[model samples]
Target: MPFQAGLGTGKLAVSKVSASEWRARSHAAEQAGDLNGALEILEEGVAAWPDDAALANSAGNAAMRSRNFDSAIQFFGTAAKLQPRLLEFSLNLAISLSRIARYRDALAVLAPFTKEGFSVARYCSVRALAERGAGNLAEAGAWFEQCLTLDPKHARALHGRARLAMQRGERDAVSRYQQALQVTAGDAELWLGQAQAMAIAGDTAEARKIAELLMQQAPQWLDGLQFLAQLRLAAGEADFTSHYTIAMQRRPQDHNIPAAQCAVLAGLDFNREAAEFARSAREKFPHLERFALLEAVYASAAGENERAQSVWNTISLKNNDERIHLARHQLRRGETDKAAILLDLVLQEDPTSISAWALISVVWRLAGDPREKWLHEQQGLVAFLPLQDAENVLPPAIAQLHRLHDTSAQPLGQSLRGGTQTAALLFDRTEPEFAALRDAIGATIQDYQKALPQSDATNPRICHPVLRYRDVPWHMAGSWSVRLSGGAGDRHASHIHPLGIVSSALYCESPPDAAADLNGDPQAGWLELGRPPPDLGIDLQPITAFPPRPGHLALFPSTLYHGTRPFTQGRRLTVAFDVRPEKEPS
Candidate 1:
């Protein structure tokens, strides 16, 4: 065969080749920076040597590198099946399964190896991930601990345990990440984890220091830059994008820096600044479409709709995310029909998209589509229940929440405006008030579930089989407390919980004005359900409004848009949580 210019060596002749020769050829292609070519060679080799476990494993590796987890799963499954005794092949198969969120399948693949007493850290680590993804956090923790016991310096196990600890609001998370960094000092993720732990613990200064150090170490690292920006924004700093600017200066050719800067600005709700920065970025990187998209989205958010529409017209929509953003732009422009069409297309592609469901619900309501009620206003979909021991729970919970709201400003990407939300998960805290409140909230959730309408197969909310499960129907996915100082313009933005089955707000304390009549003066501080965000230009009124009462809980479908009206004075404190269906064991 003729020699190839890019290939390190001449092409192989069209004849029978050994598995080792095929692997070498694939390695040469990989070394030439042609990952697709390497993957093609490995797939051909797997076909030629179908029973060769090593060839199949090599093909799996190539597919995994290309981010084709589905193909990797098939290849790795074949390898594992061909060589059942080889732990490496089984572990690789488990990894691919985990990548695609087939956690139970991954667990099944690794279960036999555990009985074989392999005692390998990598095996334990992979098992830990599968268990975590399967929603068996305790078992995941045990596996991570076992991995660390076998190899004290195992970075993945250490990182995983630290993350689990953080989720549970344990202070040990900071130390666990620090311990991992002791041996793996150059690990960026460990540093980021440690910084996040510190920030959650109300040590923003220390978190900022770690993030700044990360920026210095890896200038083009977007996560590090975003964390730094978040820390600054939370500190109420006007120059939140300072470090991002420095990062761009440090890495001149890195186009991602400016794009990240725009994202950071927008994510923190600095809409006008995001639009301006994205506009400048678009000019600087004309070939990059992301900047143009950012400019359009943020411009719309900032009420510069004409500029947003102009930018929207220039760019080509690439994916569901872009299509959703364009739909939002259309909604803002009062082109409700166009917006509905786009949202319908998105829903057609991804029926499980919470954002698409939420947006389309708004569109349907505006257009008086009967399907809107079928989707969202189903009987008992929204419930308000009063807590049993309101008097005893309110005071201490309010005080504890006040202490947790130490930051001057709101956290990044949250809907809270003119308020501070607790960084740590509220229910995970050890405070007696929070503990009691959690128990009460759990009881209230049961009551709310009991009041729900009979399960309907076609109903989006009721269609999930997990909701009807016997042993464990639901679990609190996340919980937090938000304390809004009832100053002017202090209110939550209309938003939906994307990853939740049900969402709630349990008031601990509320301003005197909270109970004011909607007809009197601006629905002051009341929970308003089914209102689209004002920026979306949807003039439709809220379907319902619930006045804030201490110990009262409002539970609604997470797909429904909900927020609050601004109050004149005093404080409004509440604990909010998202509920998700418990994963059934395989």
Candidate 2:
């Protein structure tokens, strides 16, 4: 049972008995939740039997469990090469790649399986996930369906279908969830998806039931606890504090948990508790700037401007994130000059920083340099297009958007402000309806590019290091449809599209009175621009507003904060997207 030296080789070799003993001990350690111990044993076994795929795979699995994706990928790649017949090794490799957002690498690993016509359900499901991660939703959906058709009861395939269905809308999502549950009744992820869908569909009672069941059945699953807390916050339930407490207790070591809790509390106007949580998080995770940033943000939100400024000053501006937060704080305090300096420094360090560019535009606007100067500086500000048909009415595609919002798959994300939005990457889908919308948007973007003012060094959009666009070709960053329901029909909150060069809203349906409210503020149920988020303690009013109309497409700078006014009755459906101005090839 001892490791032996290989003949004429410098490597140590292990007898089958020794390898087996190592695996047994590793398995026991893993079962006892000592993943590090398990990995240590596996690594030792791998070193002894350098050519052994099984030992490498064991190490890979342990690393994956520990969320050490880089180590997992290394081990999995070695295992896959050592044992080409073991498709599971390749699958694990692909999954590890995907975990790090190396979607193209994941697809490359899956290529052999598909090229050789390995029609395994697991392979198809994994390939689908890779495609989805690469922003190829149509391909992902097809692969999921292909997997399901190969094996009707494949749990992973069912889960994929359910997830894609959620992007469509509530009814489709419910059907997929029901089908998935029928096959895999105990699947925690499916149950979580169903709960989220229920919440988005305004069936909070059913959502709560499902969430509670998840908590009972899988108490360790953080998604369940987080979902419950989110639902409570969304519904304005009094139990949000309790739910937040439970979530924090469940994952106290996770810095994101506390940071999210603090943001939510501050957003909900629980300033005192949020301030305490931020302070605790900052003290607990001194290395993490996010907690410190949260402390400053909470202080500002609480109208403690002096404290906010003081706390923010203590944060080292080593990264663009810290600089951006400080810049925002300065902007909130009406210190435009200071904010501009910080923002410019951020852009100087990372020229492609979309958020920095967005902020710079805001600073110019607030400085009141001249409407035209700032307007020109903020490239791709606002453009409107009409989706006219043969009869000059809205096209059928625009009309179909409303029905799609009602009947298609529901997205997983629910707006904090009170609306249901589709998946962020929906524009990549090649469905006829989606394709039409994409084409229309693309054509509009071309027009927008042609109409932009000449580039100047002072303009944020023109000053990007990686981009110098003569013809403003653009790439979609994200696209989603939102459906806001009646009774104070949820208005989108004032926020900037931090990641995009341009942002847009194409109205599919407007509440009836939005068009008819001519006597009063006329712009009721309209899109308002320039106001900062309410929680920022910024009192700036909207610079302008655009009334909602069917088939009207409104495009603006992603950095300019924009939102909608509430409508008392009827649903307002719109598609929103973000885009990056692509530099044309030389």
Candidate 3:
């Protein structure tokens, strides 16, 4: 086609000829993983019709598919500027901006469409989404409401509003979500919202059930994959990854999906792929702090200390929590001091920090009194606990994910008000336990559970043990037999159990070369357990501070916080678990 005057025609020519031709070429190139061919053709299209919105849009899509986010943004911006009247162009621009996390720019692009004349439901939906991306919760909510009134069955608005409600801890949102589902039952986003609400309400089993349903239905939803990973971890079922692996089948290159994959992967074959995938994710979504976290963990796991540290250094301020989260993971690799430094830094900014303080106290449980840390942790907990509105629990529920050895709470997050929880004590009475220490932890758990009632878990009174290993009783389905090879250092921050009606640490083997005590005694590290906030000493008399011995079990309720000291010796091997009872009939 000859060049035309109208901007749209120019676009049609470039996209219909040069751009479309390049796309076909790019597809074959990408299918063979030929980056150069794809980049050349895509870049050529960019140069051919820089002002043709469709051509630019096509170019951007090709770039983004190849993980060239900067190129994508550049091309998308050109398209958006050239054709500001087209909603698709603007939406594409917005999505591209979000990928680069230029959220302000994304919002600015959508801002013009939210004016008085922009009464279209789709326009309102676009603005609502942009506001949400900008973290303006209240403004986003209002826009979503406006969109809803215009189109009662508006899918995007319903989905976005339900997510906002979940984030803000809005109880009324449950009804809103149900209505949204009624409108769009097949929507993965709506399903995710429903699952999140159920998770926050401490109906994790229900959440898991919904998640399984989603997995069964879509099998490829990102949120569904993440939820299943967390749910498995929470249930002490670490390798429960069938659904997530299936998700990877659909989105093989998604960095977050692989991050979820690595979380549950074990064995030699998976270890290599998981570590590499984590690295690839870091390279792909360089701005997403969460990617850095996965990179750090995998690097540390692979004994690439410098890369892990380098990854940590690159994280921006917006990702402070992610760094802290990784630092805690280092504790698992035997990097106590490093983990401590991270905790201190986080506490410096948030002295009333729930996660840092809780894990800090838990890590130090073996040194002396755990009460002070416990007390300090309580302060953080109490600060947000008045939000008895059950809908607000998803973030906290996310925070409740207690990974083995890695105690960092930021891996999960506690960024919202916790509605009043009945705080019941759970102890899997049926599981095996050390006769000497069982009663002590059980009583302490009961006392604390009574004093601080949280209504998040089943059997809010006492949790009976359901799963145990050959020797490790406190461990839930998620416990593992892990050994760090070669030169390795680790960090495990503080955290509570997910399905931890009761939680425990068991040392199956100890490195003969690890550090001992303040006296430089050559011995294994201690498993610390305690409360948080005012950072009180666990006043359980002599019984509270138990020095770990091989074959000696340390069992405590899941609600009680805990962390492990970095075992400085050779090949520190341990197993841990969360203990909860078989579900009572509904």
Candidate 4:
């Protein structure tokens, strides 16, 4: 072929080459370990052969390999358009769309095939995934069932069904996972899912053993290592990072082991050690920006402000997450204005960011910005609803929760200290007591939503324009029970739920001391709202405090910081949940 000179050296004269030649050259570049170069060649080929479905599909595959889902979606869509009759092209387009969380679009692409009675297991499985991602759980389950009906041993469909069972708190989740594993025994994710199901079903010991075996088999498996660390931490083992240490010893050159170790340490609240370890890791792997960021965050948590700031100064903030951490650091140093600037920039880009909103509330409070009052101090924002039939509900609920608190220590990265939180989602459990409590809480949430102020765009809560409380879609993002053993300095740290629109604490049990008059020395076990974390060096006090009552729920904006006062004696049990809006205000 006669080639014309391209605009740049090393660039392919794609116009002069056939599609097959372009694919061949691209494959050669990929074999030479130049993925970017291969992708460039494929893109040029795509431009030259705009009408070629095969060439477009090849380019889409290249983009998918690069983890550029948007580019893959574009190319896959082009291919699907050019070859409307080809099932593979449409399937690829749908898969690419699902990868980027464009679930509705994915479903739209698959709709025609569904109408045409396409009975392939893969098609049904893909539709199930899209439906699941779109929060249509029942539809997802039906699709998965259809897939299983067509092909009983389809591994992907079985896996999807098992996952859905887990999410729904079904007792059969373990058996479903087992069924999936029977077909694909070598899948690490299936094994992990089975282990998780076991743990949720109150088989923590067995779960730990499975995780331990997995770690021994695959030293560099980050998920297995993290799961093992959580299991160890829950068991009150002092040396929870032992598996990580062993992994490092076995795979000395694996940078991911050290990185995961750093994250595990920080997540488990070993801030000082995490800071020191991350600094050392950065020294060894100076090219990893993640290590630098980890060092800065852990250093800040450890109260090593100077070291944190020094590390932050060296880092180029690449994302809003990094900027959020920088803003937090500034807030801790009492540099509210600087923190405000960073937070404003973040909110400008992602107005739905709960972290940014939470931090900005603090900034406004410190800088005397009136928006603080508009955000947190609005009337009816916080509600205390006394559950009906509290006397009947309390005993069984508390007893059921006590049985679920199998661990000796609190969970990693949670606000609770000197307490043990339940391992499984409370609402999803098969216990009848939990079901009753969930129903009661659901009714309380409806009442609370009804009482909320009219929709205001500036308000975080009730910002959605929908006026009917029942019409606005929402779901419980998380539900966990906490049992605090009093007299051991047991309390919750002041914090906000970054993923929730509305947060709640339902007091299932309260200590005798907690019920005492507030005139006493310490307002024992009282829930405190709007109190900034002590480490943040903010001089603010709790805007309000509530006495814990059995079967009573306190609902408030997730952006407001909340915690509890330490009591001298007895047990305090509570169920907490975060309510996530299905759609946020535009």
Which candidate number would show the highest TM-score if scored against the true structure?
1
The true-versus-predicted C-alpha distance at residue 283 of model 2, in Å, is 8.3
TM-score of each: 0.86, 0.74, 0.42, 0.84
Task: Single out the weakest 10-residue window by summed lDDT for candidate 1.
Answer: 461-470
Estimate candidate 4's alpha-carbon lDDT, on a 0 to 1 scale.
Answer: 0.82
Stretches of candidate 3 off by over 4 Å are 1-39, 64-67, 83-88, 202-205, 212-586
How high a TM-score does candidate 3 get?
A: 0.42
lDDT of 3 by residue, 487-529 (tens): 3333343446644455565444444544533336443354455
lDDT per residue for candidate 2 within 350-443, as digits (tens), equals 8767677667766766677563345433444466777533123335555655554553332222333566555425565435667767777777
Preferred candidate (lDDT higher): 1 or 3: 1
Q: Per-residue CA lDDT of candidate 4, range 463-519, in tens?
A: 321222224677776788888877788889888888778889998888885445233
Candidate 2 C-alpha RMSD relative to the actual structure = 6.0
lDDT (0 to 1) per candidate: 0.82, 0.72, 0.54, 0.82
**Candidate 1 lDDT tens digits, 472-560:** 57778678988886655678998888888788899888888644533356568889999988778778888888988887999888878
TM-score, prediction 2: 0.74
Clashes of each: 0, 10, 69, 0
Best-to-worst order by lDDT is 4, 1, 2, 3
RMSD of each: 4.3, 6.0, 18.0, 4.5
Residue 125 in model 4: shift from native, Å?
Answer: 1.2
Residue 508: error of model 2 in Å? 3.2
lDDT of 2: 0.72
